[model samples]
Target chain A: MRLNLGLKTLSIFTALLLVAACETAPTETGDSSGGGATTQTSGSGSTTTVVTETKTTTVQPGSQEDLVLNVGDRVFFGFDKYDLSDEAQATLQRQAAWLKANPTVTLLIEGNCDERGTREYNLALGERRATAVKNYLVTLGVSADRLSTISYGKERPVALGHNEAAWAQNRRSVSVVN
Target chain B: MIGSVQKIRTLLAGLVLAIALASVARAELVIDITQGNIEPMPIAVTDFYADNEATAKIGKQMADVIRADLERSGLFVPIDPRAYLQQPKDLQVTPVFANWRKIAAQALSTGLVRALGDGQINVQFRLWDVFAEQYLTGIQFTTPPSNWRLTAHLIADAIYKRLTGEDGYFSTRVVYVSESGPADRRIKRLAIMDQDGENHQFLTSGNELVLTPRYSPTQQVLTYLSYFNNKPRVYLYNLDTGQQEILGEFPGMTFAPRFSPSGNQVVMSMAQDGNSEIYLMDLRTREMKRLTNHPGIDTAPSFSPDGTQITFESDRGGRQQIYIMDADGSNVRRISFGSGNYGTPVWSPRGDLIAFTKLTGGKFSIGVMRTDGSQERILTEGFHNEGPTWAPNGRVLMFFRQIPGKNDGRSDKVSLWSIDLTGYNEREVITPGDGSDPAWSPPYNLNR
Candidate 1:
């Protein structure tokens, strides 16, 4: 009887996952375009254009430098897995080159997880994910002293929806210049 | 033979008197509350009478706090004061039992407050078993008027103990992480409030992020994880002196901190080179002892009530599960084999069960099981619910629940909630803002 109940739950979960995948597939493209349009509008306006350009170039405190590096600052991971994928390794390679160019810059790596698991274990997993990225950057000739890692567990999420797309985006490690 | 017959007659008389006394005592309605319906007992709390005009206003306020405390517990249903057939004046004279019994009240409480000068007030209360037609218990307290709320809690505790045969957790406080702003750029700070969400105060400004504030067993000291100076380390904050200091200077990130039962040491998890392990630090000598030497993650260590054993979560068994070991980190044994992963195993103060957060089939739940992983029971299931903290009495649990965001992905709200041990009386504990990671303090006297 218990085995039958377990099988029933598994079928229902699979059905829900299929529906979520279909719904999120089209929205993923729309999100990137929407973000692009906003950035373009700010860049074209005469008054705001100067502010936006200086904000990215000045490297001020608390500023996000993802635009200047010409690469995404975050790399995604598979479910419950911390081993860096080929794509993650490529992103770290670019991040390593950028850090080498800006020798005075120090970066903090933040590891985060989705909202599907336990808090404390997710925290530990996040730490592993962040450290995995940091160790790769070291292999690429980035100074170990210039990198620090912290895990926010499932506390901080860039995507708040409860779907595969959101979860995929939430399970990531981001490098922030300090 | 004649002398033996006289002795037998005397012994029979003595036995008969003992039986009569026992029957009389049982007639006072020794309520069998070990098991019953989830329905709360109907109770009536009459307004306290004041001797002076100044104290008359405070008297009503005291009754309000007491009513709120009992109602929040979900064990006693305070009847509406408008349905009260009796007035405050009725407490001065013997309460007419017929008046209360007519309203279907199982129990009745009455009190008197008098100004003792020098900002001190004398409070006295009496609890009556209306059904049994007898007085249960009565006590008096003389304290400063500023402590009127505490004085009310004392009376409620006395009634709760006499009727339920269990200690009350009304006068306790909770330390938790207060969160605000958006999900991506959130601010969390350490905040403390009364168990009923009164007298809310922030211990840290929202300058840096903070998480998991746990009170020590000895004093008003708290151990929590903070991102101060860009280092995520465990720090201690003294509530009385308003001083803060880091517990140790480790080469890696330190998190998941908890105090030992004796409050003489701190046990936490530190991550280095992509692996996390549990470590213990003595507060007196500042000595550090590494507990678990595994490459897999081992965190969230909680000591048993007697401080002899430790319970924690580890992924060494190919998945996250609960484990137990001795205080010196020997004889490690796995205690959880449920379907999904288990984390954050907190041993009950009663030392019988361990509460944990379980994840299965895309849902998170709060559950409890015996120390040997038998008789597992999941209490609450939701889209997102974790972090179970036991009430001081071990009869209740408090945790946080998060609602999934809307289509725009911007409507997520987290709130603190509690439920009884029997899986009934689930209630939402209102807070000033989004809250998580609630830790209940030990009973007030236990701290001393």
Candidate 2:
């Protein structure tokens, strides 16, 4: 009877160890998820959360959803164009105001292109688009150091379709609160 | 011990006998296949004979792969096996050339597979000109059971080389981007496959975006662009070692990378502060040089076969066009004066012509022209077609074709397609998912 009780305790210990291992494995491999949140549950029915927050707390005033809700996160462009239209200019004005209101918020402006052009040319055009937005924001008094930019070219198309409508939507610049 | 010894002796005797029979087969007649008709050569591939049950399965599989490879090349038509008059065993002993000619088959291929214990297989095949009653070529390969498909490809290469008087591209592979998922969250991974779309494997996970994978000329190394850490940079990946490292930590984005002919340097475009220009980096000394100092975009550089000149696309002339320059980035001259914007210019391995993607009349097409931009011919046109890569022999070009999705815009498919150098025999290269940016490797034996 005593031996049976000891075996049961050892198996229970092993089960707890496995649970702990699974919980930790995702944190190491899930770097793209950004937040890298780790949840731990105690054996006594209590819960603990260990979140390894990196690069988001200082510059991001609130959650991403909150930023997208309060201010626009994207601006669209015309076909094969990096120059801003009237609509794009107005959107950038609003984005500039948002940046002014949130002083601590840093921005990452991602430039994207439609899938209709060459990959290398699209990258250059995307950079032009992002730079256009950044220049306009600078004129509105946002510090250039607080804003960084990257162009994804046609590699990251928001629209999967080959139609003009999808391509129109894919050519845009998005602002992400770091 | 005696039984094992006897088995070894029997195998040796069989090898010697096969060699003797092959020499006799060669003495029958000689057919010059150099001037065959423009139409595909009609061939019959018999099922390979097997020595055992396990080998029988592999033998049938290998023959199927070989037949598919030949047929997909658009140079040969594989006659249906059901129309074959004799069994595989009978053909292995001796192919009745008159029977194949009677069935309208100009070429006949027969083979045998033997199990050499310990999971080894011996594959022997012969290509015969049925009308001329001559053996074109015969080869034997021994490999592990798992590598039976490669053995079949090697046989197909032998047949192709013997018939065409050109190096066979069958033994090479293509590196491309496999795209999946919805448009907004599309996942692109680096993938490689045999030239015939066999032995497909993904080299990278979709967690990071990768593009434009180009194989090295002398090694199993690939140079490509990856958006890792949100920094778009050039990276080198070794196929044999499964190790990858960023080519350099440039202060800006680097894209459109291609390896030099010697695989000792990489040429790509680096964009910073709204300008993109061509740059070259020597892998050995980590030395970086600016190849082009244009304010406009200069990218998609390809080295000539001799590595003395580079052909690339640039918009410095107010519109996108093809340009050529010396290895040190001097004597820049425009090579494209067509009606459309030209980009993604790839110099053929033969170093005589350049393949490029043209955008005109609101459509995209793949075309080729002389290095001096003469005798321009558009190969294929569609809604979206780009990224033309050449086969190892420089006789064929492969690119991606993107078909429009439905009204909901959900099922868009991008597939790889190949075309002959003369702009004939266009065919789709099948892949498991959407593929783009295909770069063909040099022939497998070139480095050796």
Candidate 3:
């Protein structure tokens, strides 16, 4: 019965998650990758298929000392994909475990994107990405009420240079927690 | 032979080095035009060639109107047409680039007025990108001589869009609630005009009290509040169809009507006695959905681009601030938490920044903050500057400022103005008579 309840809840959450595009829904949000993704060239001119947009991140049981999470100070998605890479999940899992231990903690998840898309669209997408991470943590037993999301879109940029490095850094969601 | 062979090798290396340096320059020239010199583009507006007396009268009036429209942009510095190099009539052929460049003009406007045989006038205008040495656009419109002002406005819009790569607000119109006289004898009217400050038409004629006049998302339809027969009601006006319809006849007062981004629904604030909240009504079905139920003043709601979420100004946090709620009015979160009080949160057409009115230090200023409460930057500051509407490109903000207690308190000129996001380009928008509370419309889709 417990297992059935867990599966039922998971499926319910899965449906709600896609509809809300987060662990929770904030009002009308559209996740356009600003524009579509830039086809990444892998040396021989062929393209890589989109295997996973967002990786299912699981918080490993640990203390802060056990997880010196890179949390990527930055993560780059293709155009507008808010999905996590294998590396991104590893970083998120560590951060998730930290939040699991720190129950009294509250966080501000800031959604951000590159300068490639329209401002409003990028902002909504950013919010959606952060909400995705927040929802993943909620499913991992972290309290959903503690996580709040806001989209910076292309406004508050970390790097001002209009280059690949700058765009890579800017197209990321930083987990700002208090 | 040895020396010649060595020279060829050296030349090849030098050529390769040059190409590398050129490519690096292309990458390094990152002019972060986050802000531009908001100084108005210097322009010359000569009298368009007119035919009849009415056309001649309109030609001069429209030239003045275009000048005012561009000057208010704070982006263009209007040059005195008296100092023009060539008459607008001569501009039909070509212009001497050297002379224009000599006058230090980066952009110029040339137009001609023609008398259509059907007792109407046709005006043609073009904006020249002097630096690019090309015409941004050449537009011709035929209207009755009385619409000379609109024709001038159309010319200004064409010039504006061509140069800025955005739709011009000049040919557009502003529907605002005009207030006059003292608080006891205050008269309110739904006033309309060409974006260039001509053709002042009063829809309500100051006989009835109107609160807000918001433009429809797709058409010339205007949705606003009217206190007709002492009952505050939401009303809609189809400018072309000459049709006026009531949105919903709720028992309470309804105000602050704004069309959704798709133009299918109208979101507004309704008050039942002392209780106020936000609601959305489908124009087709007349079905109303209450989005906010807080006893606090939850008003001034604007939808996100996709219409799934909304941003509004509320006093829920014990003070007037900005909040974001879901489309169903769930998961309400506060988006503004800076020191100042914020209201009239307008979502950008591009859906990024929210233009708002901020009252800090007892002064009203127009500003924009990110969707979250961080990085709140004030764009324009004044004693009484409020109500910011974003240009279609999300580059400029239009608002109004009044010189309080100036000219012995008799000359209370609350006029429309615009400024770039960078706070540099500040210009007084041209409007017929004194204007206030300007709202920019989206690009004309089916509305025109």
**Which is the leading candidate under TM-score?**
1
lDDT, candidate 2, at A71: 50
TM-score of chain B of 1: 0.92
Model 1, position B59, has a per-residue lDDT of 87
Off by over 4 Å in 1: A1-26, A29-68, A97-105, B1-36, B407-409, B446-448
Question: Weakest 10 consecutive residues, lDDT, candidate 1 chain B?
Answer: B1-10
lDDT of 3 by residue, A124-148 (tens): 4565567667766677777878876
lDDT of 2 at A145: 93
Q: For candidate 1, what is the DockQ-based docking class?
A: acceptable
Off by over 4 Å in 2: A1-76, A85-98, A158-166, B1-37, B92-94, B117-119, B446-448
lDDT of 2 by residue, B165-214 (tens): 67778878999999987554568899999998878999999878898999
lDDT of 1 by residue, B1-448 (tens): 0001001123122433354345455435333344534568788898889988878877898889888888887778888988989888776655788889999888888888899857778777777777775666676766667777777776777777777788888877899999897665578889999888988989999777788888897768999998787577899999877788998898888888999999999989988887999989999998889899898899999999899999999999899999999989888999999898899899998899999999898888999999999999898998888899988888888999988656233467888999887677789988999999999988766213
Which residue pairs show collisions in model 1?
A: none
Error of 1 at B248 (Å): 1.2
Question: What's the TM-score of each model vs. the native?
Answer: 0.85, 0.82, 0.60
Ranking by lDDT: 1, 2, 3
Q: Predicted candidate 3: what Cα RMSD to the true structure?
A: 25.4
